[model samples]
Target: MSTMTRTPELHPAANLPTRVSLADTLSQTMTMAWRAMLKMRRNFEQFFDVTLQPLLFTAMFAVIFGGAVSGDVSSYLPILIPGLIAQTVMTACVATGVQLREDMDKGVFDRFRVLPISRIAPLAGPMVADTLRYAIAATLTFATGIAMGYRPGGGVVGLTGAIVLAVFTGWSLAWVFTWFGTVGKSAQIVQGYSLMVMFPLTFLSNAFVPASTLPDWLQTFVKLNPVSHVVSAVRSLANEGTITAEVGWSVLALAIVVAIFAPLSVRSFKRKI
Candidate 1:
């Protein structure tokens, strides 16, 4: 009668699988992207750069530099629209680092680390959501150009190609800034450094002016600059409606940047969190 009852074993620690499956990773990344979109929705001001910059810069640059650069604003539209698309999208890319650093400072990423999800979800999610911002910037810049009498010789197909390329450029280049976020001490520092990197990359390229107009030395540098390739590709698409070598070069550059910085950012983020 008096028999000793064996108590069932209890394991106090339960954990998710060490490696998340590819499907799970994709799902989690999408969920995080949705979360980022919600944040953007709540903070409507986040749209300011994507919205206002295209409008202001399109009109102002066309007016101020149009006559000087290309004889009139009308002629300048073709050149300026594509270049502005590149510059505006790059500008939006900078915010990705600043916001990531801010989120880290606020302990948001710390919470993300505690969850049983793939490490890259948080990193890639916002960048994925930011494609919308890039699209908006590209579209608005094109719209402003058309409204100001700028017509793309490439027409609808070329315009669509340009927009797609611009969005890809923003998303890919954002990896560099995302790495900055993981390593930077504060949001301001990240922003300052990001701007330092961004200004030279954008302004030093053939964005607003023809590289042929610059000094030989400057032109060489501009030719070597990857942004120049992107600008050239956008122009070729939006002006000529043709896929050129520049487009291939730009795509290669974007791929190289992501291949380099994306892993670096993820590693750095893992360490910090």
Candidate 2:
């Protein structure tokens, strides 16, 4: 009689315990994000580009507007400071999409797609890194503003709130850039398209000046521009030391924008991957 070799039965229960915990997943995502940050650090030029351009833009605006528009550097410093901060943070959002497109073009994402990681984690991880970029930009802009003699009447707490608001706005806007990155054909195209879209949203609003100063037809649009509310909110916090309905409404509007765009961006990212 031939002995029958019985193969050990595979147990489903044995496999169940092998699945990764959410904590482990999050740890892995953080590792990936850290790696991405390391890569950025090694590439010093790219890092400088992201960090320096915003600083130069802020300084240029301060000089141009200080001399030409306001004619009094000290007087305009207060108003221009908030506007520069708003513009810088808003512009920083475009880098998310442009970088995403660059990574995709370089097949960095293709490697990520093959890994056994959470789908949303890759997209989410880069966004986490981008927050650092936002922080850097906001800090530099604020420091430069102070150097130009712009004093925040709201004191330390109020100034802190303004920085937090700017960072939050940048984070919310990243979702919009993520969608563009996933869908756009090339990094250059993404940059061009994103600038075209963002320029009006930023400039047409009350970022630089009061909406009342705009023409009647443009004033209506500027008043409705979400950037106007954000600028107004920042101005209120930094200049007045008070939180008004404008701040509340601006926060709500940013929340709505994130609610609408973030999921769409994730879905698009999923499809692309």
The 0-to-1 C-alpha lDDT of every candidate, in the order given, reads: 0.93, 0.79
lDDT measured at residue 229 in model 2 versus the true structure, 0 to 100: 87
Q: Per-residue lDDT of 136-244 in model 2, one digit per residue for the tens?
A: 7777777777886888898888888888888888888888887889889999888988898789988898877667777999999998988888888888998888998
lDDT (C-alpha) at residue 200 in model 2: 94
| Pairs in clash, predicted candidate 1 | none
Instruction: Give residue 93's error in model 2 in angstroms.
Output: 1.5
How much lDDT does candidate 1 score? 0.93
lDDT of 1 by residue, 164-263 (tens): 9999999999999999999999999999989999999889999999999999999999999999999999999999899999999999999999999999
Which candidate has the highest lDDT of all? 1
